[model samples]
Target: MPLLPGAEPYHRRGGPVGVLLCHGFTGAPQALRPWAEHLADAGLTVSVPLLPGHGTRWQDLRVTRWEDWYAELSRELLLLTEECERVFVAGLSMGGGLALRLAAEHGDRIAGVVVVNPSVRSDNPASVLLPVLRHLIPSRPGVVGDIARPDAVEIGYDRYPLNAAWSLARLWREIQRALPRVDQPLLLLRSPRDHVVSPANSALVLARISSIDVTERLCERSFHVATLDHDAELIFEETLEFVRRLAPDAKADDHQG
Candidate 1:
């Protein structure tokens, strides 16, 4: 499938400390490009893969399942771990779920995890109907560009593919079962007024995870896509700080300028 302009995956080689960034469902790498570049500029190797079924037409996503997306993330993560001495996984929304799953399965292999308004579970009534509705409906209105910036636009399909949503639900269920196994340091940033993912999702993961080091920050001005929203710089800086505290010898302080 032909990828949309500016939606290509990103990879940059920098230092022994590597970071793998994953975008949310229905979102392209475009959403997290700035964040990846910030880490790369700070001399950290970075990999941001465009998940399967994203950055293309909505119909194409309908045919894909969560496993396909998780496989792509896993591939990039393994590649980074092979070359870097230390590695971290950062994700937004559904990508956060994938990160959590990685931490669960890999244990201390993942140095830490950073998530922005992650969605593990939703109380939306529509979600309950996804299994049956997916068979009858091809798409529904999508929640894209939930940014606080007045003119910012997150270029993704306008329609939400029901079949893919059902697959996402499956991923969520699987991640829930493995939450107790995630012991890596966790940094969770959530927007107070997120219109897409609810705060409960983050709270649920926070309550269940066994990580001894966990920090939660409030993105006061941004929305769901906090990586690209008003608090973007804050997110980038905090991430660097988190990485530095863990890998003190890494040259991550260079990009703080």
Candidate 2:
């Protein structure tokens, strides 16, 4: 399948600390590209893989399951582990759920985790009908481009594939059950004005995770897609700081201007 313009995966080799960023469901790597570039410029190796069924048409996504997306991220993490001394995983929305799952399953292999406006559960009353709805309908209106900045755009499908969404719901339940196993340092950044995901998602994860070293910050000026919103620079700087604290040997100072 031909990838959408700007949806290409990104990989840059740099220092001993590697960061893997995962874009949200229906979203391509483009959504997180700037953030990856920021980290790469800071001298950290970074990888942003286009999840399976993404970066293409929504019809393609309907045929894919959540496991496919998780598998792609897991593969990228393994590659990073082979090349770097320390690795951190971060994601936006559903990708955040995947990051948490990685921390739970991989344990000490992941140095830390960062999530932006993660989606662990749906507040929509209609979600209960997904199993049946997915069989009857192919898609629903998309939940993309929820940025506070009017000019910022998120590259993703215009509709939500019902089948894929059901799979995501299952993934969330699995992550919730395994939250107790996530002991790595966690940085949870969220937007209070997010229109897509509910704030309770972050609260549930925070209350369940076993990590002792955890920090929560509010993106007061942004929306769901905070990476491309007003506090984008804040997310980039804070992430670098968090990684630096955890991996002191990381080459964060080498690329300073």
Candidate 3:
């Protein structure tokens, strides 16, 4: 499958502290490119890998599962850990769920976690029929590019793969069970008017996670894809600040001013 332009994986060598970024289901690295570049420019080693079946077509995603996606991210995280003294994981949407899972499984090895509109559970009416629908239907309307900015576009499959979505749901169940084990410092950025992930998802995560140092920010003007929406710059700046707070000794780019 040929990847879309700008959807290729991004990596930059910077300092001893690293950041691993993961994009949402159906989304490619293009969605996180700016964020990755910002962190990288701030002198942090950064990696944003395109998931196995993403950045191509919905058909590819239909054949893949959550394990495949997580495996790829886990590989990147492991590689980052080797060269960097400390590593933080940040993800959007389903990517956030994956990051939480890593924090649960890896524990103190991960320096912290940052998530934007992450989902561990869904209360949508369609969710109840996912088990049966996944077999009966292969695709549906995509939830990609749910940004408040009308001119912003997210490069992703036009269709949503039901089989892969079901796999995501199953992963969410396991992530919920492991939530209590996510003890790292956490930063959650949410969009109040998100049409896809409900605010209830954030509430559930805050209620379940054991992270004592949890911070929440509301992306009031953006929708589901807040990273590319009206709050994008704010998200970028806040995330950079989060990293700085975690490792005060790390030097930032003078050009940021």
Candidate 4:
């Protein structure tokens, strides 16, 4: 995994209900910044950690794998768990996958989860052929949001990284295995125009989670990375509502007895 970005201000907020934001593969924390700010404004601490080999050259991604990504996210999540009484996990693309893993492995510890176009499956016809085709494909790099990257890089790479996809495939399998163990409230967001993972992946999450406290929404404006797209605001608003409904201050009977 590549080095993580500075999570300083986020660490400084200090609170009970913290929100951890994970960026996607070849993507940086820029995509999650808006969401983080919104949550922070609501008095909830937010942390948007850059995944390994991301927010840098695409070549760095070649040496990283899914496990590396999970380790880093887990570290950040554990830290939040220590400082905050309750925590929620949110991520875009591959970061979304990591968030799912975090919730699955630490279900009892997390308050809830928000997944935006999580990339558990590539759905690319190429990866299924030889299984290793993902590891063999070369990808340039990609980012989310038409809203301009913080680092000022284009969104989505032209080239496809075969090895990276292979790692993602493995990661997806792990999430699948971990699904049965997860029972937290979830907000799943998907874009109809997304070219990455198939919608079926979202269905898998809805069906496998041991609990039914899950809600899935389709982003009308976004493509793959709903973070920076047209529906980003809606994603943020709905996510906030979900979080509020689950907050400690919220009445348990607000939605039901």
Q: What is the C-alpha lDDT of each candidate?
A: 0.90, 0.92, 0.89, 0.72
Model 2 clash pairs are none
Better of 2 and 3 by lDDT: 2
Per residue, candidate 2 scores C-alpha lDDT tens digits across 152-228 of: 99999999889998999899889999899999999999999999999999999999999999999999999999999
Q: What's the ranking of the predictions by TM-score, best on top? A: 2, 1, 3, 4
- Which runs of model 1 end up more than 4 angstroms from their true locations? 252-257
Give the best candidate by lDDT. 2
lDDT by residue for model 3 over 1-257, one digit each (tens)?
Answer: 68888789999988888899999989998988888888888888899999999988789898899999999999999999998988999999988989999999998779999999998897677887999999998899898989989899999888988998899888989889999999999999999999989998899889999999999999999999888899988888888888889977456433432
| Residues 62-177 of candidate 1: C-alpha lDDT, one tens digit per residue | 98999999999889988999989999999999989899999898876799999999889866767888989999988988888899998778878889799999998889899899
Position 210, candidate 3: lDDT: 96
RMSD of 1: 1.6
Q: How many backbone collisions does model 4 have?
A: 12
Quote the positional error of residue 209 for candidate 4 in Å: 1.2
In model 3, which range of ten residues has the least summed lDDT? 248-257
Backbone Cα, N, C clashes tallied per candidate: 0, 0, 0, 12
The local lDDT score (0 to 100) that residue 204 gets in candidate 4 is 78
Order the candidates by lDDT, highest first: 2, 1, 3, 4
Better of 2 and 4 by lDDT: 2
